[model samples]
Target: MTQQPLEPGQAPAEHPDAVPLYGPRYRENPAEIFSELRRTHGPVVPVLLEGDVFAWLVIGYRELHELMGDPQLFARDSRIWNQWPNIPPDWPLMTFVAYQPSILFGEGPDHQRRVDAMSGALSEVDQFELRARCEEVADALIDGFAGSGEAELMTQYVYSIPVMTVAWMMGISTTEIDGVARDAVAALDGGEGAPAAYGRLAATMQNLLAAKRAEPGPDVTSRMLAHPVALTDEELVPDLLLVALGGQEPTALWIGNTLHLMLTDDRFSLTLSGGRQSVGQALNEVLWENAPVQAGLGRWATRDTQLGGRHIQAGDALLLGLAGANADPYVRPTSGPPANNAHLSFAHGSHGCPHPAPEIAEVIARTAVEVLLDRIPDVILAVPAEELTWRPSFQLRGLLSLPVKFSPVPATRS
Candidate 1:
């Protein structure tokens, strides 16, 4: 059966009991709500994003996998979204869904061009050197707070390592790293002043691109400039921005979430307490249970279809719920150890994250956490874990702060 596209100027129908994806309730413990959603609505559930916009949320592992793999049927280019013109400029989701000339938002041959250029540039990065730099940064960050004995891990350690590492990869100078980090955070949060924040971030990338063109280095930007794809500055800038943002934010969140699991959950704590699970195994558990990216970008339907028993009209938007799909009871057993890379946290198919393979991300995260643990073996949460607050963003799942206490030790790095 075919479902007709909603006529222009007509409002999409609302699901009276549809869950809102962002709010204090959802942020506090999304897993619970996700489980309830799966039980009540099966795989494809209707959801309300900010601005009361309606979209289909794919929660079943198999359903999300099929949708991502069949990109021809479910396109990534937001330009084809039939109701984009009607969405307000200030709509909360505009920052994510609006058309951009980057690999992330393109489709078909255009997507191939952008991804090829991006993958080529990323391939030039020396993984061994990258890991060493990450370790050095992690040690230095830990050194800064080692003496204080009480620090917020998110701000002091987890967040800084990824940004500084990414800055170095892009050949951004020490002086400019702070500014770029601030703007990147603002842009990702999509809070008030997000537009201005995005402008500043773009301006920073533009300047970086110019400098790389003038004096090319071994950085990713220089490699991109030298690639045969020959992306012009306009094309080069957004892709650079995508790589930097994509590399930093999710990795930071992964580290923080993994640390949180080790500190709070007994199963992970047992692993840390000399049980069977290694840090890498614990990290995989986090990937399956509390993925950094809760939901993926919207994929527009190319033709009328039925998904998980719900009618989906052409041009309708669907969001792949990574965290929710990972929690789907069908694929993941409630009692067993998590299988490595079994979840859609990084997504799959043509739109999967091309750079920073999952293995590299794991190394970066594991190294950071291991360094902190080695330096402060007795580190524990300063307050009850339940009291910790989470960032209230639809796209990200991370803590705002993770205050920890440990015996003061001298700075590890001079």
Candidate 2:
């Protein structure tokens, strides 16, 4: 059944973490705040996170599962989103490139076509190949810090692998691709290192797209260019840039977050080391427990609809929480504790992130580390957990640094 539109004067639930989007509380402890709402307001609650505009906040996992998949009830478009006051200029550009029009963001036939085009080369066999390549990349990166006994896992390990793999797939030189990916992700929030980095990354993707047009290769960009979908130069360039840039950082962070959580939680650590299925289960736990995208999902109400019993009007921006939904007890009954089910790190429905492949890769990558740790009994945290600095961003989740020490078992005195 399609969800109904929101009605007027249905005030947002009063919660401490319920604040304007610009506030730090929104960035810092969104899940905590949303949890409060879920308890107080039930599954679907009213929210005003984006600005003063009201939209439905889908708190329960089941609601998100239904809402994200049902296009007739909920809609996404760059234009409908622009009406909100205080909307960022780059917001539309980023949304269009990163989410809307992208396969995950598209509705109806356009979504299917775009997905088919890009996914042809990303088959299960291709995914295996990507995993193999990622394994090699992971080896080289981990080796770089092997002798040091301590290294920033995010910069040196987590961030490097996906960017390199994506670049390799795209036929971009690893040297150029890694730096560009790093700079672009750093610039996402338009902060200190953001402006210059964003510019360079943007220019690089634009140039590469042009190059691909003239001489297409086996990469995703080449495939996209060959697709039947009509893509403007404006759309194609920034869109590819957004994909290449946005893809790697979150992946890297999730990997880091998983590792960080595993090392900290005894039960999680034991499960991850159990076996393949155990590791897979543990991976799901990590995704839910430490989801990288801390903020809720973003959407604009197309027209008035009654969702979760609240009245919402057209142009209402719904900032649904991915992490919140996954953790909700209603979604997955709390069996013993909060670690039973896989987290909603990827999201639900047609618009959910197409990251099962990468997520699998991330699990394998982190599990490999666990395997190594088991093999090497002396591996230990070289630095305090508090010393680790996580990347500061409302959109992405990851660590900035993870320094650890390992005392390798002495070479057997043969």
Best by lDDT: 1
The TM-score values for the models, in the order shown, are 0.94, 0.79
State the C-alpha lDDT per candidate: 0.82, 0.59
Model 2 TM-score relative to the real fold: 0.79
Candidate 1, residue 346: the lDDT equals 86
Q: Model 1, range 192-261, lDDT digits (tens) per residue?
A: 7677777888888899988988999998889888889888898988888887788788989999998998
Q: Lowest-lDDT window of 10 residues in candidate 2?
A: 1-10
On TM-score, the candidate that comes out on top is: 1
The parts of candidate 2 lying over 4 Å away from their true place are 1-18, 21-31, 45-56, 88-105, 187-200, 228-235, 268-278, 336-343, 355-377, 386-394, 408-414
In candidate 1, the residue pairs with backbone N, CA or C atoms under 3 Å apart (3 or more residues apart, or in different chains) clash, namely none
State each model's C-alpha RMSD to the native: 2.5, 5.3
